[model samples]
Target: MPWAHAGYADADALAWFAHCEQVRADGSGHEFGIFDAASGTLVGGCGLNQFNTVNGFYNLGYWVRESWQRRGAASAAVQALSRFAFDELRLGRVEIVVAEDNAPSLAVAERAGALRECLARNRLKLNGRFANAFVLSLVPGAPNTIGGPLSPNTALT
Candidate 1:
């Protein structure tokens, strides 16, 4: 809900999928759909993007449907995606940036063991406006506070 608006259409979805595939093919990033394990419903999405390969890091982002809020969907996606970013891609850092006022996402970052690094100015462009954001990082070799490191194939609840 936070990342999307009400006017999304079928054409928009098609373009989005094409973009995701292109990103994967080009090695720029990987995006994944978060599905509910029990019923196979899409609950959210998470991805590792904005790669800084030279620095061994990627920017991680996620969003959950309003109906699925507080149900562990985003947390599970974060852990899974971070695992992939670190283990499969051999990246050293995963950065999660959240708008200063986005409490739910901020909580998800904290709950997933990301260390708060700083508050960055004009860090994000939300709905045509710039806003401050909290920068957090999840690094390998640190203790995972939520679920342990999960495989990318693992089903999210």
Candidate 2:
């Protein structure tokens, strides 16, 4: 969770969660925690955020626990969230923006069927500084299917 908590203090994290709850209640977007079904353990989180109403798309993000890395947890959660974005939310597209150097996250986006669009310059403000990011996208099509367990992962914004 270092990436997710990089710039935030405890209070900031708390405020972010509070805002997420409010957004969910208002139907602006959705946030979900990923869990292990058998053990009922929290592993990660995934969500649809940063709604672009004019473009009809949502930003998708997720991160797995250290122990859960390479276990397909993030991919599963992403697929579920993407499905929700297209089906329940009726959104046309979902974007996953990750730091260009973050290979693990880039792989997760690829596994979830996201297409790499471009490397945007100074696209994200991480911790305190700006960083480049790869903007991957998932649009409604024959290949963008959601069929996996619902789980959680760290998000970019």
Candidate 3:
């Protein structure tokens, strides 16, 4: 995942958790681990990372494990996060920026009802290289079933 820290060690992951705690404490963002409901196994993680308070929007991010790929876990995680951002945080929009060559992620965004807003050039720097990306967005009050109208309490497990 280009969006994620490359070659993250255990300490790096721990530091990330601490950062997430600080972000929550400072009211900057929210991050959560995605787990399988039935077995309670960690499948991935999803979060509202970058907050654009001026625009009332957030940058959404998620990644599923290789074993969980092709399943609906990514989509579900995104939907739950989107619901959290829109309903709980009361944010205006959630954006998913994906590399153009990443077909699976693009599909996930599309399946989550994100509208492709535009193509941004050299928008992402991954592994010391710049890459183009498609900016997909989901706005509140949009007529979409990606994140079904579940009660706030039911969105995340």
Query: Which structure among the candidates has the greatest lDDT?
Result: 1
CA-lDDT, candidates in order: 0.83, 0.81, 0.81
User: Comparing 1 and 3 by lDDT, which wins?
Assistant: 1
Residue 152 in model 1: lDDT: 44
- TM-scores of the candidates are 0.89, 0.83, 0.87
Q: RMSD to the native, candidate 2?
A: 4.1
User: Which sections of candidate 1 miss by over 4 Å?
Assistant: 1-3, 144-157
Candidate 2: list runs displaced more than 4 Å: 1-17, 142-157
Worst 10 residues of 3 by lDDT: 148-157
Task: Show the lowest summed lDDT stretch of 10 residues, model 1.
Answer: 145-154
Writing each residue's lDDT as its tens digit, candidate 3 over 10-99 gives 888899889999998987788888777667788788888888878878889888888878778778878888878877987878899998
Question: Model 1 — TM-score against the truth?
Answer: 0.89
Which candidate, 2 or 3, has the higher TM-score?
A: 3
Candidate 1 lDDT over residue span 38-146, tens digit each: 6788887788899886886889999888888887778888888887887799887889999999998999899888889999999999888999999999888877433
TM-score of 2: 0.83
